[model samples]
Target: MRSDIVPVLELGAYAAHIPYHMTWAHEQLPYTPEHERFLELECISDILEHLL
Candidate 1:
């Protein structure tokens, strides 16, 4: 995992998530902005943790 893959995944997840997860925006959507951002944060954190 180069770490950047997560963004690509999350994007694909967001795009495909609607039909794959069968979710709607108001109906507790599986892909939330906050959650995706959280994953980004986690990815950066993991990178920093590995570097330091």
Candidate 2:
């Protein structure tokens, strides 16, 4: 992230958490299925670790 923008990241062992990284556009957006699945897995893993 730029110094002018808000930081969006977490770093630590056992500090598992998904960092939000969204984008907005005036035109249409393009994304691959693999990217979506990866995002889901990250959230799921974070939740699982939090619960355990």
Candidate 3:
């Protein structure tokens, strides 16, 4: 778990920690800011859907 993300989640901010897919472990994907932002938005939308 990312300790940096823990604080945001614990503090009830609009933040999320998304787990990587098993396939990601088999492939070498470049970790970039755009990818991170996309994942964060995806997780946030998922959480919102669950809540609402």
Candidate 4:
């Protein structure tokens, strides 16, 4: 993933199924406490609908 995904696409994984990967991405990103709280409150589809 580091070689093919990171270098090839140049866009790091935004959302990963593995908890470790999600934690890593969140580390690189700016802290969003509200988003995290929303995720806990809403379904993924509902959250995506709000986003999309």
Instruction: Give the alpha-carbon lDDT of every model.
Output: 0.39, 0.32, 0.45, 0.32
TM-score for predicted model 3 compared with the true structure: 0.29
Q: Model 1: how large is the Cα RMSD against the reference?
A: 11.6
Predicted structure with the largest lDDT when compared to the true one: 3
- Model 3, 27: alpha-carbon shift in Å? 19
Q: Work out how many backbone clashes candidate 2 has.
A: 0
Best model number under TM-score:
3
Q: Estimate each model's TM-score.
A: 0.23, 0.20, 0.29, 0.18
| Clash count, predicted structure 3 | 0
Q: Report the lDDT tens digits of candidate 4 across residue range 1-52.
A: 1222223223432431112334444244343323221232234455565468
Clashes of each: 0, 0, 0, 0
Off by over 4 Å in 1: 13-52
TM-score-best of 1 and 2: 1
Worst 10-residue lDDT window, candidate 4: 1-10
| Model 2, span 1-52: residue lDDT tens | 1221212222211222243465434222253222211223356555664356
Q: What lDDT score is found at residue 16 in candidate 3?
A: 52
Q: List the residue pairs that clash in candidate 3.
A: none
